[model samples]
Target: MTVRVDQFPEVQGVVSEPPVQARNLSVGEVLGQVTELVQAKKYDEVQALLQNAMGQHPNNGDLINANGYVLTAMKRQSDALRWYRDALEFSPMGSGIWNNLGTAFKHLKFYNVAIACHQRAIALSNNEAFLHHNLGLCYAEVGQHGEAIMAFDRALALQSDFHLARWDRARSYLHLGNYRKGWADYEVRLVSGQIPARSVSGRQWTGTPYAGSRLLVLAEQGFGDTLWALRYLPRVKGLGGELIVECQPALCSLVASLGVADRVVAKGEPLPEADYYCSFCSLPGLFTPDLSLLPAQPYLSKPAEREAKFEPYLRKGAGCLKVGIVWSGSVTFERNAERAISLERLLQSVDFPGVQLYSLQKGSPEQELQGVELRRPIIDLAPELKDFADTAAVVANLDLVIMTDSAVAHLAGGLGVPVWILLGHSAHWLWLLDRADSPWYPSARLFRPRIEGDWDHVLDNLAIELMKLATVKVPLSSVG
Candidate 1:
């Protein structure tokens, strides 16, 4: 077969052209074009070109590599793996090809194989910080925190300015209950990087002496995270500083009750004048040790109306024990579906004689209270809940709160109330591994799932504990 080459008269160059009725270009040329197309996010073109190239050069390493990348982009991970392996056979020196294989394996939950491939990539190209970071991610996913931290450390050693490795190392440390290190690493979120979606830009933070300075601290992330991190506010206040806390609208009124801040405003509202700014979540990182010496009791300002209206509903009978139940957690969270149990399961297992079950649950769980033996029939207090303070008022009235790891749990723990938190097998980083109590929340008790995605066992254990509480007889003064 004769290949026709076209000569450019003006440029004085010869370019490869489809010879009269020719099929296509060489495999390398096709792969090169496909690489460009994929980089440009032209997935359809990349797929078409790769498919055509594969027809001619099915065993070509470059073509297979391009095909693997395209398949990965299309999320056809399994198909991508076969191509990546085939490409590896031809170009064993290519670290990128190995890394792509590792990524595909990682997505498929093949952790062991992914780790091997990533390690091979690292051995091939030790200078590539991304490969080390990617390996760190895979290690973390597979519950190998030590290795993950080491990989992150390697990545940091290679590039000191890499914020992502810093974040990953801190997260791994936090997961392992290395709070001293975790909190220190968590400071990376405050500086320049991927800013969260908020309009709090242009606010300056002057870490100058707090004498007569007003600091505006904005809330970030989930409800529970904000509530848990707000414990350091008293320290900030003790520094002769006034604070303006801007939080979610729902939290403003409740947070105001804490009395730590001079002013509490909902996010996106008008801001008060301040000499410094910080995020509410960064509190623990800045408020150094002696955490045990620090008070864990609730600091929320009690709302007058909430205390009046909800107190009567929590009337404790002479013989009956009052317990607040929260079986299901928020579905919006990724791990919630696995962690939260069905209300039916809770109702079936809970056996507490002379125990009055009340619903302190707000929002979505309000509908599930139908036909249940709730003391006050679950009420929708979402509208009335001005902040965590109102919720705290309700929790303060209850003898104990049994809840999934949600905002309520944090609120209860922050209030110095006894709270049993039901956690998923792969629970949040704060829970740590194999322990009942949380250092962050002294009053919080963690009950983790024995098996992955198993909540039935957790409920059974909770029911047994509740039954024990029901039979116990304690003096009136000792109850609180």
Candidate 2:
């Protein structure tokens, strides 16, 4: 656990036992070819090449470092650590090795150690922008957004065109409620090519008058993002002659009902000719970075037939405070572990007097409730819910929705249903920082954990809030 390189001063004494030999290629020449193979993603080839070189020059710092670099790229962080330790012995002053060593610790989630290593690397080589970027990411992991921003600023100052740094810097800003600055840097995602920017190969809409031409508004990112951004379509409707919306098939039915677009089409369907294309998530930056351009909630209505289809199940909890809950989001999301709460923990919030809890969770997470005993009976609606449309119909009947941050939060909030969002210490930037309410969804009340992944405390606080509501009946019109 002693990460400070100074603790291992003996590393400077001796290295690689009794291997005095030479190779045709010098260590620098071997590193050049190793760099090429690494750039080509031939990690195994780089390892093989390094192994051969290390046999001839066993104590060489560059060879040891190259082995560690390729292993880190291969995601063998633990294995990489050994090579990094060996590299540090021969070249303790190597800033590149220090940076690589920091990354290995980072992959292992030894963040404080990684931060110290990055700082050491920066001390030796201050001009490396990516070293500062790595340091900022470690800071962001622990909810130090202000420090993260400063590190990102230093990275950007060193390399202004570093889109990766800018994109993360923007997220830090967005998390801090600096929407204007956040939105400006957020546009770098288009050129960063990190996350896919869903757009057509036509003119990009830039908030100009769209009176004469067709504008295709494409949905991007997760279902929660689309659900949140759909509220902005009405504002876009007024700016165009024909506003065509292309979204995932699960959302087409719901998006069509909003009537904001001239045409609603599922993604990957037949092409709709348009003069311009824009991303639904990008609407804010084009119109206004701040929250002023948002249209009213409940822009989408429950389809009457869908509502009727779900009424029999919804009516089961007639005299109780019907509450819907979604404990998790898509598993494929990189940050799902942070945003998602366990169903066992989430149920604690709904266990108040006279409150009926219903599970609105879909996907494999519904399996968690299969054999579980509960203090209060929770109606399982997962099998009955088909898509966003089906879920919206069920949410329309709920007195409230209490769940972790997920698509259901947005679904309920967009429908103007009262929703209490359980947030992580630092995950979704849309919720902003240190606030109990969201400007994007007036109906949403946010809650964050006192400590990382401490859902029990957050839910306990939420239970107190829900207990107050249990004493008073939720008005019918307040939801649907």
Compare the candidates by lDDT and give the number of the best one: 2
Model 1, position 279: C-alpha lDDT score: 80
lDDT of every model, 2 decimals: 0.71, 0.78
Per-prediction TM-score, please?
0.77, 0.84
The per-residue C-alpha lDDT of model 1 at residue 364 equals 74
Query: Model 1, stretches more than 4 Å misplaced?
Result: 1-53, 60-94, 104-110, 197-208, 311-321, 327-341, 344-387, 454-457, 471-480
Number of clashing residue pairs in every model?
5, 0
Ten-residue segment with the worst summed lDDT in candidate 2?
Answer: 1-10
The digit string of per-residue lDDT tens for model 1 on 246-327 reads: 8888777777776778888888788775677888777766664334554546654446667986755655433566667776
Q: After superposition, how far is residue 34 of candidate 2 from its true place, in Å?
A: 6.0
Local error of candidate 1 at residue 336 (angstroms): 4.3
